[model samples]
Target: MRKNYLLGMALMASLSFYSCDKEVIYVQDGNGVESVADGAQIITLQVENGGDGLATRAGRPLYSAEAKQTIENVKLWICDNTGKVVYVKEISNWNTDGSTVYTTGGHGRQTTIELKDMDKLAAGSYKVYAVGYSNSSDYVLTDVTNVAEDGNFSENMVLSLSNTVGEEIFAGQMEFTVETGKGFKKPIVLNRQVAGAFAYVKDIPFMEGAKYLKLVASAQNQSLVLGNFNSVDLAGNGSGNDANVKYVVNGENGKSGSETYEISSIDLNEWFTAIKDENGDNLIDAGDNWKNPYSSEGHPTFQKGSAFGGEFVIPFAHVDGKQTLTLQLTNAGGNVLRSWKVNLRSSDEQLDQTITCWNSVSTDWSTEVTDESANIYSLVRNHLYGIGTRMNDDPGEGTDPEPNPSDPDDQPESLNNKQELVLKVNDNWEVIHGMELD
Candidate 1:
């Protein structure tokens, strides 16, 4: 039951007409998709997810078990030379989806889906787009038009992860020609599209009186679009941290002057896959766990010591830019003692919202910067930067916990004090060891 699908095109995954409920469509010459050619070109496709999701080292070719499994659907597409999507299919539930057994690349016993429609297409240039994800309702494909028509790739394929938690998304694309018997042979390699983070604090002399310490990370922008610019926009729909944040303290008789105020910070627990712990997981005890580069994948497995540290995964962010995770020392009365902003940024590029970066040491936090690859100072996708810092130095400035992007009193600076941001990066579930503040 096939027909010419030359109708209006929308790039949404949940389009009623093009639902991802294991639907398949192809292009044919006649008005109606009836009698097909004798031998339609069918291409065998398999996927390979290199070394567990994240790496402890740069470009470390380690695969991840999270990527190995949890692939609920492989939404694959074939676009014409001009970016007009012609063929579409959702390969899922491989057990009965007419897929053959595939055990070569990543996890054993996957599937080898036979792709059609290439031969039906006239010989010319074409591209293959594939996105593998765990959930069907977590992503949105928007801000793209005309390309879905007969236009060029003038716009972006906005894969909005703004509202999504740390959901692991893998994408692969390739260009090829529809000529003779030749077809793509190499396995499509899917790479991680998010980053990982965690914090730890130790030896905070006043924490003995403050009782407990916690880490709060705030991102100025939520990665709205994906492209060369890595497009982003202000978080409005529930915000990057949502309108209401967790662990909030409305400055009631607050000891720390600035600490007693409305705080709008990204809830690490809500946005990230796993919030280190309800309080914090002491990362100092992370002996063997610290050894693994992609340890962020095993959130629950991390053993907590006496320090306030734990790990979670986040979207690809410019940590050195508008995103930062700060350490806060609070007394039992929910009063702030001293705060230190993980100085990763070189400038004051913050979100449009009213967020402060808190007071850092007299000397701002600076890192050995370079390209995104070597700059463990920034938060990039498919990479991990383990933050092993010791907050044993004197508390820098004001105690207001709510970070203001426009605040000039206590601004962002280079890494000062003995606070060395232990950002050791690697590749999937890329591991960024927790930090420790004394």
Candidate 2:
């Protein structure tokens, strides 16, 4: 009896050890094994506006509409063709309001999970699942899609002006139209690039609370074409040098149009000269001398401010049901000088908005306004700069120049040197606006 009791205690100890060493697995089936295949590939998932799907057949990329809540904490994962887990990653949040929830990801809300190194992916159909957690909760929200061909289908387009740089200086205006085979929805005009591509959809006119339409971009006379798969930049070199170039529109449907214009470079030398002659003095001695106020970086200039203003016309074809249009600006340098955006609605109503960089440190850096036009709403922001009358006197007659008041405790007042103009268009085009420095 003593031997039997000792044996039973040994057996219990062994069972306890075994339980501690066992791995915990969560399985869809009531099996103890984790049923994940090795070397599986998972693709990125996309989120669409209005809870729509972003399949290519749907004609529009998936997107999340502008909402009051912020999206945050986007996590992505992948699986192989053989139903095995392969890879996982977390995405950085890109919203402005600091919300950690993610409304959309993976190819502008179309593909949720993008399979990495797809070239290495074996030729087979695979399934991808995406789980998104909102900023409000940790519950994993799931979205899934199928991956077939190892290539991308969507195309990207960009537009910009060479002469429009520095503070809000007027360049030109353009009108764009897009048509696709699939039905499109919930157009967005983005100021920044999406997924490594620039978008020109800003400060235009469109309908309010509409989901199916998006605007890519608008510029003086240039547009960019993008690759059908990756957002590779395409040249719109129509017929001219950099000083005066034209834009040519080409797409899968063979649509074509043109915009004519000239390029501009900034003339910093002229501005420096004007600043030195503030007191009507021609020399830069003593009181007239100022610190190096010129930029070593290149400035933006225009084609002699021609009296013959030009217009841009862009056309689209390949009408199926609905299509998404995108525009972008590339290789932008220096401070943005000025911009304008206008949108024309189907009801012949227009909406417009403009932004002018303000010189306030405490106040908002920009101002905005809205206006309406006939079938063409307009948004304009014209920024200007001027020298102030406050003068500075050199303390040593011809030595170190000091503030006119010469009080070491006094602070120099702020001044506006240059102006910039920017325009943006929301998905809703009902509001027209503009802004300027007072």
Candidate 3:
């Protein structure tokens, strides 16, 4: 037996800036008007995958793999012709798994949903909408019932870094006119609301016996704020000094040997200047680019506003072009072992390059033939400040200056200083010879 449930209460909800499709199809009666003898209507609420809702084939799934999830419930809304929400419904009960909920019969086996007390709906043009989600608690609810202005809806659907479930949100809307007697079968095609980027380490030989590697987003926080459906507006008041707000790759347990980390929400600013004026001189110099450990014998957190922190930085948000991500290899004792501060972007590029500085097959950094003409190691050594060595044409080449020249031995320059690392490459570039830090 089919049960008929009704929530006769009127729904007063807030409006959002998101728009819906304007075209509507009405199945007319002999009188050319829709008529529902019992003042009830049935609609097919389609549950499909949610990325860029493109079906590769005619009957393929709707969402892309990166944004696909099992949708558990849907929040439906009916708005008046004036763009005012008139009714709302929350539907959760369904028959099959979300992946198989949509079938070929045009009617869902056990997924039928109803809009009750249709007769109470005033005669006017209207639009119907549905939004589906898996985890309800992950999102901040927006009570838009009282706001009178247009739909600049609050960040009601923002997904945080902790929200492993609500990462995929889907919604669909259609416009239709409501008359005294009619409803027809309608389908809602849900679209996904997020974008993603990924990172990984390459050439393990240089990083042997290493147990930790972290990728830190200079200004981004652990939580990602989805301001717009497909856009991420990084949180925090641009106060990049907040330690807890900055997002760092927290690998499972402690370290991940070359595992890829997904960074979904990030804001890239070309002119981002960190407060590196260590001398209070109000100007940036090599002295300020040093990565400072939180405390003695502690791991270094890339300095708050330094230029580059030895981690791969991909400006996915920047339109100019893709930038290269640099890599640093360190020892178990927190000493800089090797720095491959080169233009290696993708893993394929890193693996295919002819440079023989560090390789996996050798399993030993020393075995790498630095004498190879194309070897990056030789190029790095060419810049070292030997007693009578001629400075390479590269003016950027030289010996690393002491980070704190006063206590040069105890506070040696960190590898985060590109110029210093290059100048002292022979010492800092190899674990067998580099000056180990305290």
Q: By lDDT, who's the top model here?
A: 1
Against the reference, the lDDT scores of all candidates come to 0.31, 0.19, 0.26
**Number of backbone-clashing residue pairs for each candidate, in the order shown:** 52, 88, 12
Ranking 1 against 2 by TM-score, winner? 1
Query: In angstroms, how far off is 295's CA in candidate 2?
Result: 13
User: In model 3, which regions exceed 4 Å deviation?
Assistant: 1-40, 50-68, 93-100, 105-110, 118-120, 142-166, 198-206, 212-316, 319-438
Candidate 1 yields a Cα-based lDDT of 0.31
10 residues in a row with least lDDT, candidate 3: 9-18
- Per-residue lDDT tens digits for candidate 3, residues 161-252, read 33321133344455555556654543343333222111111112213344333222112222222221211111111111222111111111
lDDT of 2 at 316: 22
lDDT of 3: 0.26
Better of 1 and 3 by lDDT: 1
Error of 3 at 213 (Å): 5.9
Model 1 segments more than 4 A misplaced: 1-69, 93-110, 116-120, 136-138, 141-155, 161-165, 200-213, 228-299, 304-324, 331-335, 338-376, 388-418, 429-438
The 10 consecutive residues of candidate 2 with the worst lDDT sum are 1-10
Residue 216 of candidate 3: its Cα lDDT? 20
Q: Score residue 48 of candidate 1 by CA lDDT.
A: 29
Tell me the tens digit of each residue's lDDT in model 1 across 1-438: 111110000000000000000111111111222343343444333432221123131121111112222345555566787777776666665323523334222222234344455425566787655554544434454432122434344322445443323444444455556655443332233344444343432222322344434545544223323222111111111111222211100001112322221112212222223323333432212222223222334331211221323322333233344324455556556566666544332221111222211112221212123322222133444433223321111112223222232333112212224343333222222222222222
Q: TM-score of the candidate numbered 3? A: 0.37
